[model samples]
Target: VQGSFKADIKLEDFVNNSAAVVQTINTWVEDRTNNLIQNLLSQNDVTRDTRLIIINCIYFKGTWRKQFEERSTNENADFHEASGNVSKVKLMFTKEKYLYGENKDLRVQIAHLPYKSDNTHVQFVFTVILPEKGVSLDSVEQKLSSKPQLLQQILNDGYTRTEELLLYLPKFKMEASFELSDVLKKLGMVNAFSDSAADFTGIVSKKDDPAGLYVSKVIHKAFIDVNEKGSEAAATTAIRLTKRRRLASDIKLVEFKVDRPFIFMIRESHNNITFFSGKFLSVPLSYYKRALRKIDVIFLDELGSEAAAATAVIMATKSISFRPKPSPIEFKADRPFLFYIRETRQNLTLFTGKFLTPTNFS
Candidate 1:
């Protein structure tokens, strides 16, 4: 079961010592989260003007039904980025029977992994929804939100059957912080943040004073660490007068490699109510190294200074088809080769080199 804590504190007592208030609140958060969250609020965030601070935190720790083998994890696995850049990542590997399926209409892949349970009746499944290589997460979310039934189908038993699954999930740790004032305003809760228009008489003693209290800022922080065993995640939301608030694929063996951007959800298997959902984007830097190419150009610098130096030089050229063609013949360069730069019209060689290796060239 997930544990959550909620509390409200007055800022008047610690008006002069904001640091102490921050430290106290952070300590409470750390204690509630098993020290997973150290500093939920900073000294700079708490001030004399901050009258009421409302805080909420949720912590979850669970073990996987089938734990991955630590030795099978590859430290350097290719993770494809949306920008077409491939980077290395610590990819956890496992081959076991898992609830898996694919949707041709949505062009998405789905996989379900249940958390360990002693009762054997209550099941909490973590489902991953991955769009095709070119498909975006935004599109998937939009489609799901518009047509809620589609989501039910994706999670239903008919869509996913037991299969021998080859899974490659990256070991990742992510911490995210956000200011949600603007988001709430955009969501049509405009009056909540406006100092003049807001009406929160029930919350604080602002009887007829329209300018008395209005949400100034809403801050939120979340963290998740996933590894061989399972996951530990914590999230905290605070409102300072503020209030406002807050892949795949497949084949025969059913290979499911989450080496790219995808969406995930933790749901109660019985009712299918999603408790937590998020998108995983951008792999760790250590996961993949970028393919780099270097170009070295040798230009005739003296040609500009000396007007008479090879003024009308011509270069020999070979034209190849820029469009479709059959398989081209392969030219292997295992042995030494000759390279020449010559003035085509004058039939005079300007430079010649014999290449045996990169370091040994003449």
Candidate 2:
């Protein structure tokens, strides 16, 4: 029941002082996320019609139980891209005992790296899911999407043993932002976003207004940084009420080199709550150089009414765009992979994303 709610701003301000409103909301977002997430809202995202907004923000920073040696990191390590290209990246190396497992069914090597936590009830672990070399990550994604329980099964049954491992994980930083109204609609959540069908009478008394209220937009932004010391991540989600709409393991010196694309997640050990989950499909710009050589742009315009003569104009332009080995116990992630953070007790996912190419390298 504990929460933070703000209702002082008037709907008129959303129209007349949108900039100020946006700044207020964004500032709150930035502060809550330790400045890791900023500008969660723009003026265009708010209007006079907007009646309410709900926001949630989370920030996490964890040190590895056994930190990587700063000097052991390789700055020029070659990371294999899914596109068959290679890029030089900063990869951190460590030798440590970690929880590890392999799911032959999923064709992935799993590694579990625990974070330093003083509270026993709040344990967190970072998990990496690396698909076997030459396996398409898309296929794995489809299976996971089709069967959500498969992920839980992987975490519970796949990683059953502890092993001493030589780990090579990339030093990376990434940020992502998404607008989810359409996505929600496509997921069968339609009534809340329909201007005419939305029902928010419980949230607001709409007896006097025929238009009532509906969701207009949902915005989400996230950031994460992984380095020798540990991991830092933050995410913010805002729901605008304006409209109705809306690791592996290994043991035995078994090599688990993650030199290709894979999936990952962070979660709480006890509850299996995943905080973050994403895939990293690292593709170097050079991989797309050939495609970038040619560029095409197409524009179409329709003129005239239904009863009148129809005229169409078409314009075209062209634009173009575009591992490792190891010991049996080694788990080197030199390619794209997915990762996430989660709370063990509550089984809540905190932050997750793919480690494609390192932002700096890209």
Candidate 3:
């Protein structure tokens, strides 16, 4: 049976000597997974602010019952992209009897690639689902959403007979890391990420300390490689959960060329639960670049009304001088310019002047 594991460490200790701790954890993880993963946590990831750190690692190495011949692999196959572009990819070719089926309703072709089974009844299989041309994996996924049993039905009993199938699958490698805090929150996991709203008192019990711990980050990393020999896969998930309440059947020799966007999964045969599933849109998961952009936007508009425009400019000013301090005054001029000197308290006009262009001054 699987069980949960937890560990408690002082952030101060790590903060004092973060290099040692980071190196220790990274080395431990690397050795645990046979060096498939390195640098599990960076120096910045384990900082003084981090209250607690939790890590989970899983590793697997399996051999295919029938491996693809290296010499037969083709490097000139065109992989059709959803964007109507085509790229050349190395397709591993194999001719073997695979469990396969075609769902007329779903409009998809399913094939099963079984790994070498051990003494136990449980086995591991890589299932590939390929949609027909002019169709999309998204549509097939939508159909699966409605009919969740489609995968199992197709895998378990959909294929009646095993026949010689010519399979062409791309040889690729994938490594992905996801920050799932916001994604979890959007799925109704609110309190776990909320510092004030979370309740993980059971995780740590110290009445004197009232930091109100909550989960700050949940990081997941995965790696998978498929070659002529077999598949080597490993993944590590670090909760950093903090004291806070952390949170196919192949019928005939029908050609199933995976020269396009398709989905695949590494699942156990017993329960048919997916251990790792992903869409292979292209090769080298890091083929796409990461970008950060900063943009500045300034709004422009015409005031339209002279009174409003003048009022806006006056209100926006930092300084304004008034003669009597509290007295109210009104002055409106449409044409050029005008000024008047008067005895304000006695209401007597002493002088008046009007000026237009520079010609008037000249």
Per-candidate total of colliding backbone pairs: 6, 63, 8
For model 3, residues 211-247, the per-residue Cα lDDT tens digits are 6456776655544555566555552222111111111
TM-score leader: 2
Better of 1 and 3 by lDDT: 1
Candidate 1 residue-wise lDDT, 1-362, digit = tens: 02343335444454687788678777776676566555666566665555556666655454667877888877666666655666666666777666666666566666666657565445655566666567665666676667656766666655565655667665554444456778878989787676667666675655544336666666655444456676555411121111011111211233577776666554556555554444555643321221121111111110100000000001111111132222211111111222222222222222222211111001
TM per candidate comes to: 0.66, 0.78, 0.68
Looking at model 3, which ten-residue stretch has the lowest summed lDDT?
Answer: 305-314
| RMSD for each of the candidates | 24.8, 15.3, 32.2
Give the Å error, residue 283, model 2: 5.0
Off by over 4 Å in 1: 1-14, 119-121, 145-149, 156-158, 207-211, 235-251, 284-362
User: Residue 208 in model 3: shift from native, Å?
Assistant: 6.5
What's the lDDT for candidate 1?
Answer: 0.49
**Model 3: colliding residue pairs:** 99-248, 99-249, 99-250, 100-249, 100-250, 101-249, 213-244, 214-244
Candidate rank order under TM-score = 2, 3, 1
> Each candidate: what lDDT?
0.49, 0.61, 0.48
Q: Where does candidate 2 stray beyond 4 Å?
A: 1-12, 208-210, 235-252, 283-328
